[model samples]
Structures are given as structure tokens and as C-alpha cells.
Target: MLHVISQDLSSFNTLGLRSNASALVRYEHAGQLPALSQLAQTYKKVFVLGGGSNVVLAPDLSALVVKVESRGVRLVAESSDAWLVEAQAGENWHEFVGSCVDKGWLGLENLALIPGTVGAAPVQNIGAYGVELEQRIQSVTAWNLQECRLVEMNAEACRFSYRDSFFKHEPMGRWLITAVRFRLPKAWKAVLGYPDLRQHAILAAAGENATARQVFDAVCEIRRRKLPDPAVLGNAGSFFKNPVVSPARYEALHKAHEQLVAYPQDNGDYKLAAGWLIDQAGWKGRRMGPVGVHDRQALVLVNHGGATAQDIAQLAQTIRVDVAARFDVVLEQEPVAIA
Candidate 1:
């Protein structure tokens, strides 16, 4: 357990927003749980931080920030075709995906280059290229804050949804995910859930001939081209999730607006493409002050240098309001803002 005071959060958070914490604690090991718990109890308000990817910090922080940094990987079970692997929270998600690629574990390769820690994967139910982390998750090990005990929850119990989980819903802030277990196949089907990936795979001859490594490389290349790196220009990948609505509502919109793009969900719902709507709303590459909508991906709001958190928020709100006015759909942000 590492405790530090007056730590700067700008560098830690990818957005580079200058939010100062009164105190910050780094929990890098599972064994340090007891000490961290005791410290949490001592503090009035506690906030947990992981990859610093999907968050926008307020200018002033009112709680003690605990950075969950636990790190490791364990292969607990194995069979001829699959393995039950556990990874500590601090393990960089992309690095872990690379490791799985090296081992020929097939589930995570398409999600390569996704930022944040393993523990955060389930929280957002992080999805890309037709694959979500929840589909690969076996279970999650978390610290129950109210009970002050460590507990394990199976995949079903996690109540996975698009960019959501049990931790994000019921009894919010009730637990801190410590480690996540994933059961991946050594030899498996590489699902091209998204049409774009499917076409890309076909172009690369990614049918039965493509290996997991090729798929990972191809997906990473695709993402690199589609999404701007926040390290270079400030922006979160897809600031808002694709909105899921009833099939009837989707069809209604489709009939009215023939250009609207949507994907049918398994449960008879339809996932509306937020990007297509935002781009149609004429926000792409539009600049205001220091913030602007990314030219390539309108769903992403960019901070084109000297942009403050408020400026980004304002621009995003404008886009949301415009989209909402044009279509009857209300936009929701994917990033968690702590004010």
C-alpha cells in the first residue's frame, strides 16, 4: 500500500484535466487490502480509480482517491481447449490482451489496444468490434465495502449490460473489483460481431485461415485508424455508448429517417449508432473555443489543446442537445464525471 498526499491527477488521467486530490492511495497488492480497508473507513469519502480512461475529473475533489493498482495473472484451471485465468486489477488491459495473444487464448485479441485495467473491463462491460469483455468473463473478485470482506461473483451475477455491470448499478460503490477471471478457449471461434470487422476479416482472408494473432493485429490496426489516440489529441473513444431501444421505436425512426443506422439486439431491441446520428447532426470536425468534435468520429469530443474539462463538457452537451432535438433520442455519456 502506497499513500501519498497532494498527488497530481492530470498526468494519471488520460484527459489531462487538472483535478487535485486531498490524498491518494495506491493499492498494488491483494495482501494490502486490510490496510486499505482500514484507511477507507478512516476517510470520510472514498473514490476508486482504475485506468483513468473513462472519467472526467472536477476541478475540486472532495474525497480520498484510492488508485487500485493490484497486478498479476494466474492460470487456475486448464483443459484441452480452455483455461480459467485470473488477472489482478492493475494489469494493463492491452498488455494482458497481448499476453493472451501470445498464449493463443482467442477471446481478447479483438479487444486489443483498449485502455484501462482488467478490473475496469467489466464495470463498463467494455465492448468493441462486436465483442464485449462480459462474454469472456468467468467471474469477478471484489471487495465488498459494506461487508468489509472479499467476495466473488459469477458472470451472470455481474448482471452484464452494454457499458454497465452490477457494480455500476445496485448499491453503487458497494464493492471494489480486485481481480477478474476469464475462461478463454485455446482454440475457438473468432466472432466478427460488427459488420465492419467482418468485412475487414474477409478482406484479410480471416475466415478459417486467420489466427488469433492476425485478428488482433487487424483489429488493432482498424481501431488505430478509426479512433484518435488520446495521448496525441485529447478525446475518449466513443464518448457515448450506442443506445439500445425497442425494435418498434427503431423501426419508427428508420421509416421516418431512412439514413438512420441501427443494429438489432438479440432481445428484440435495437442498438442505434450514436456516431451516425452525431455526424448527421453536423458536429464532425466542428470547433468551438478549444474543444471540438473529432473529424473522423463525431461521437468523440476532442480537446484541441488548452481545452478545460468544462469546455469539453460544454461541447459534448451541445452535440447531445442537437442530436436530441433532431431525433427523439436522448444521448448519454460513457465517461464518468466526478464533480
Candidate 2:
């Protein structure tokens, strides 16, 4: 089992801020379930953490952080075309994708290089480069702290939406996911729906053809060049999710702002590009104290130096208010705020 007796948690989080925890518990395996669960009874402040990819703290949280590190994978079924595989929660997400790629699995190629762990993937229904994790998810096995038993939750039960899931809404901090099961295909089928990805794949193939592996490689290259490395430059990826707006509202905005780029959703709505909007408003590379919006993608607010959690919040508020006033649209942050 994982153990932590230190009062400070500066190194543990990706944000690189010095904060204290009353106590920190790390679970290296699922077998440590009872011990980890027992802490909730003894402590008032408790939270589950993954790779620290999508969170901003109000302060070095004074809670007991249960760092779930259950790690492993097992293949439950396989055929010529597809394989059913289950991965433990703590497995680093991109590394897990890399393993599947090395094994010639085609489904996860489009989601390469996303931060966080497998267990946390389903919570946000993490997506990228025209693919979402929900497409490959078969079911998730979680330890329901309320019921004190293991339960298998299917995709529908997960309630996935654009960057949201059941765990993100209802039953919010109740169940801790232990493992995730995915049904991956052996045959490559590249999803080139996203314009930039398609263009990249086409350019790379010289108008011939690009496979899933090629698409994955191209997407990784794009992300690496566009986004700063979190390990080197503290960030939580995209700080704001692309906002989904109704079609009529989109039309009005389009008429008002002709240059606005939006994607029409199946539900007769539109998903506006938050990054473009932020950049248009001139927030990119703007700094206040040690935190600011990323120079490349304004949606990604970054921490440059000794930025407290409140520093991140203040910058976000300014962006939100300005964007709302200028465009008449509300921008919602993608990262989890632990205040």
C-alpha cells in the first residue's frame, strides 16, 4: 500500500504549489480499499486524486488526499477484430494508451498524450482529436463507498456528456473507481472528423491514405508543439471546455460576429471554440502575478511561478466576465476547483 506522513504536498500535485494535507493516503492496490475508506470516517477533509491534471486548489488543501494508485490490467476477452481489456485506476493514462498502441490496439490512438489516469478518464469522458473515451469503454468497475461493495457501471450509467459524467455530477464524491474496461478493435479505423486532424493525416499521407497509428502520431505531435509540458510548465491542460450553445443562439452570434467558428452538434446545437473566443478578446499571454493564460491556447490558464490557488481563480474570473460581456456567452472552466 502507498503511504504518506508528510504535512506538505508540493511535489505530489502537478501545479507545483506548496500546500499541506492533514494527512495523505496513497493506495497502491485495490486491496487497500478498506484502509483507504476508513480514513473518510476519521477525517472531514478528503478527496480522491489522479495525475492532478484538472484541478485548481483554493489553498494547499488542508484535507486528507486519498491518492488512489491501484494499478494493473487484465484481458477478459479477445477475437480477431476486438479485445476486451480492463485497466486498474492508477495506470497513467498516456502510458496506458501507449501500451495499447504497442499491442496494436486501434481505438485509443486518437486520444494519445492526455494527462491523468485511466480511473479518472471515465469521470470526464475524456476526449481529443475527434475521439472520446466513452466510445471504447465497455464498463467501469468501481468501489461504491456508500454501498461498500464493488459494482459494474456501464457506459449509459456513466452519463457522459461533453467533458462530464455521472461521477462529475450526481454521486459526486461517493464512489472511487478501481478499474476501467475497454473494448478495442484490432483493425485500424482512423477518425478524421476533426478538420485539423484530417488535414494533418492527409498532408502526411500525400493524399494517399493514413492509418490509425499515423493519426495518433500526428495528434501527439500537434499537442506537443501547441501545449506546454505540464511537468515543465504547470498547467491542467485546457482550462475551459468548449461551450455548447443552442443553434439559434449560435446563429445570432454568427450574425453578430462573422468570424466565429462553431461546430454543429447532433442535438441541433453548436459547440463554440472557447480558445478562439479568448484569443480574440486578447487574453492569451496576458499575465497577472505568477499565473496567466497560455500563449498558444488561451483556454489553458497557466501557473508560471509561486501562484496560489486564488491566483488561478482571479484570472479565470476576469476571463469569464470579459468573454461574457463581449460575446454574451458564458464560459465554463473544464478544470475541477477544489475550494
Candidate 3:
């Protein structure tokens, strides 16, 4: 394990928040888990830092921060129905999806350009376009800090539910995901259900016979056009989760505003577009000090420059309150904050 005291974490998070951890331990291999477990036992509190894409970090963290940097990818299993591929926790998520598509292992094309690491995918149940990571995940392997051993959990055991899973509920640092297994089907179909995907020129040209690579390219292009790059303008993609409402609630909202953008869920609920809500609430392009809602995409809250986590939190709270008051629906933040 490589240890550093007063580690600077400005570049660690996609939000580009200037933060520091009292100590940071980075391990690149599973063989270092035993030592990491010992340190976890010694510390009063521990936090796992991944690609730093989907997080809001405090200026100073007083806990031990473990940076999981393990890396590897391989074809683990295959059958007539599907191919099981494994990726280490630290692997770049977008790159992994691209690789799978390149190798003709289709199914993850709709999730192209998602930020963060492979290990972080299951934690957030990361989804985009028309696909969620849970739909493709086969299993997850992690080092259990409390147990001081490795553990594996199948997809069902992960308890995935819209933008959440068992990993999110567990105490921070309780489990350090080492790798993830994905089941990609040999027979693939394009998922252009979303209006953006359906209307996109690339997919529109391909019609019903769009290939996985085309879908991947379309998703990437759409994302680039909609979302601001973290490198150019620091932001964690979508700042809030789409609020799912009952049919009655959806009806009320629809009656109130005919232009409300929403999608029906399999469980007879309606997932309201958080971006539409925020935009209608008159927060788009609005700024509060150094942080503001991205002008192009209301769902994104960007750090204008030199913004603190507190600033982002306050702005998010204000937006939530305004949205709740305006629409009588609550907006939940997607990024996990660490203080």
C-alpha cells in the first residue's frame, strides 16, 4: 500500500473540489488487501475513493481514505446465451464499455460515456440512455473490511433499484470492490427508447438495425453535446435523481403542466424528469456564488470555479426546496457527499 499524509485530492474528484485527506492509502492489487484491512481496523473511520466522479468531498476529511486502483480485464465465462466479462474496480467505466462494444460483446452501448470506475457502477446502479448497470451486472467481488476477507455477491444479492444498490447502503469503506463481472448477450438489439436517442441523427439513419457500435457512438455524441466535460467545467453529470411518482401524483403534475416530461416505470410509477422540474422552476443557468446549475442541462450542477462542497450542497438544497415548493415533488441528490 502506498501511503501519503495530507494528501491533496483536488484532481481525485470530477467536481474538482479542492480537498485534502489526513491520510490516503492507494493499493493496486488484491494482495495488498490484508494490510489494508489491518489499517481499516485501526482507523476509527475509513472512506473509499474511486474515480471520484460521483462524489462531493469536504475541504478536509479526518478519516483514512483508501484509493482502490486495481486494474485488469478479461473474459471469464461464455455460453450460448451470454459472455461473462470481468473488469477490475479501477478500470475506466467508459473505456470498458467501449472495449466490450469493440469486441462485439453487445448490451452496454446505451451506457456509453458514463464517468467513474467499474467498482462505482454497482454502487450507483449507473444508468444512461435506456440502460442501467444493474441490467448487465453478473456479480461483484469486494474485500470486506469487517470480515477481513474477500466476498462475492450475485446480481440479485446486490439488491439493485434505480440508481442504488446494496453497496450504497453499506457503511462507507465497509467493502472495497475489487472487480465486477458483466453478462453481455451475443444477440443484441438497439435501445433507442429515449426521445434523445430516437431523434438522434446517428440512430435515426441506422433505423431499427442499429449496431452496438452505432448506439455507443450515438450515446457518446449525445452526452458530449448535453453534458459539460468535468475537465473543462467541473460537474458531476446529473446532480439529481429523477423522482419516481405514483400514477395519481403523475396525473396531478401532468394536469398542472402539460409539458411535464416523464417516463413510465414497469411498477406502474412515473419517473419525472428532474431536469425539466429544475428548468421549469427557473434555475437553469442560475448561479449562486462559485457554483451554478449548468445552463445547457439543468440536471447538472457545476462548479464555476474554486467552489466548495458546502457551496454545492447549499445550492442543491435551495434547488430542491424550490422544486418541492413549485411542483410538490421532492428532488433527491445523486452524488454522495463525504465530509
Task: Say which candidate scores most in lDDT.
Answer: 3
Candidate 1 Cα misplacement greater than 4 A, ranges: 170-173, 201-203
**lDDT tens digits, residues 303-322, model 3?**
98999999999999999999
Kindly list the per-residue Cα lDDT of model 2 for residues 164-198, writing each as its tens digit. 99898854447889999999987666777887785
lDDT of 3 at 260: 99
lDDT of 3 at 208: 96
- Order the candidates by lDDT, highest first: 3, 1, 2
Ranking by TM-score: 3, 1, 2
In angstroms, give how far residue 19 of model 1 lies from its true place: 1.5
10 residues in a row with least lDDT, candidate 3: 1-10
Backbone N/Cα/C clashes per model = 0, 0, 0
Model 1, 105-165: lDDT tens digits are: 6688888999888988899899888788888899999997656899999999999988988
**Stronger candidate by lDDT (2 vs 3):** 3
Tell me the alpha-carbon RMSD of every candidate: 1.7, 1.8, 0.9
In candidate 2 the C-alpha lDDT for residue 284 amounts to 94
Which pairs clash (backbone N, Cα, C closer than 3 Å) in model 1?
none
